[model samples]
Target: MMKEIEFTLNGTRTRTETQPGERLLDLLRERLGLTGTKEGCGIGSCGACTVILDGKAVNACLVPAQAVDGRELVTIEGIMQNESLHPIQDALIRHHAIQCGFCTPGLVMSAKALLDENPDPSRGEIQRAIAGNLCRCTGYEQVIEAIQDAAKGGKTQC
Candidate 1:
């Protein structure tokens, strides 16, 4: 049976109908029309379906839509404010951390989760935070540098 779930998404109240076993990723991308969260490896290895759930970074593909009921969920599209870019997005640009950009949204969301909790995270902490995200381009050095630079108040990298 389909169930109706309500939650806060990108700072807005939203409700959707989901099957008993529908993943959050499917609801976000297919039903809710939030395509920024991509599905790279549906098994949750690639971190492409990463999203912030109750202030924690989680793999959307692994979370059932019903699990998010009454919770605060943040996606890549929700990170922006008043047309201004989120710090992580700015940092990625300033650092040139993106190449093909397929993993950009997930990477940015992961960084956001880290920065939101600890604005000035250590390098090791930052590394641990994003360890799940896999970037096929830019070698991750630039991505790490970008995140670090952001912690140090540097401007956008790309």
Candidate 2:
């Protein structure tokens, strides 16, 4: 049976019908056409599918589509405004944190969630926030630097 679910996606109200046991990852990628959220590990061990759900970062693959009803979700695609990249994204690019670009979205979202809650987080705190996210390519040095730069108000000027 398909059930209707209403929620806020990327700051916009959205409604969709989800099949039983459908995951939010599939809903976002397949149904809603939001492919920025990637699925690396279907079991949630890898944070490639991370997204901000109601102000907290979560693995979209582990969340039931129906569970998101009346909630707010922010994917990497929604973090930008006016065709400009978010500060985290800018910092990541400036710091050369992206490699292969497969895990960038999840890292960005995790960093954003941390920054949203704590504007100025310590290096250790930033590390903790993104510990769940595994980036095999970058090794997290530049990624951590990018988050730090973003915390220091480093925004890329286009």
Candidate 3:
């Protein structure tokens, strides 16, 4: 059976129909047409489906579609403002942290979640925050550096 769910998606109130067993990844990418949230492993290990849920980064693949019925979700598509990229996205580009582009969205969301809670996280903290996200391209030094750079001025309404 399809059930109606209401939630705040990228600061907008939205209502949609979803089956109980549908994954949040499908709901975002297929149902809602938000494809930025990629599905790498589809088993919650790759962290490719990461999204900010209620102010924390979570694996959308593991979360039920209905789990966000009353929650706030922030996907990669939601981070931009007025045609400008979010600080995390900008930093990733400037720091050359993105390669292959498969995992960039999850990395951005993860870094955003960390910076949201701790605007000035230590290198170790940054490492821990992105530990779940696997990036074979940049060796994570650039990613960590990008997150650090974003921390300098990344704390905003994003």
Deviation (Å) of 29 in candidate 2:
0.5
Specify the highest-TM-score model's number: 2
Q: Write down the TM-score of every candidate.
A: 0.95, 0.96, 0.95
Scored by Cα lDDT, where does model 2 land?
A: 0.93
lDDT preference between candidates 1 and 2, better one: 2
Number of clashing residue pairs in every model? 7, 0, 0
Q: What lDDT would each prediction earn against the true structure?
A: 0.90, 0.93, 0.92
Q: Which pairs of residues clash in candidate 3, taking residues 3 or more apart in a chain or in different chains?
A: none
Q: Which pairs clash in the backbone of model 1?
A: 93-157, 93-158, 94-156, 94-157, 94-158, 95-157, 95-158
Clashing pairs in 2: none
- Cα lDDT tens digits for candidate 3, 1-158: 89999999999999999998899999999999999999999887878899999999999999999989999999999999798999889888888887799999999999999999999999999999999998877779988988998899744322
- Let me know the TM-score candidate 2 reaches against the reference structure: 0.96
**Order by TM-score, highest first:** 2, 1, 3
- Candidate 2 C-alpha lDDT tens digits along 1-158: 89999999998999999997789999999999999999998998889999999999999999999999999999998989689999889999999999899999999999999999999999999999999999898899999999999999986432
True-structure lDDT of candidate 1: 0.90
Which candidate do you rate higher for TM-score, 2 or 3? 2
Cα-based lDDT at residue 21, candidate 3: 81
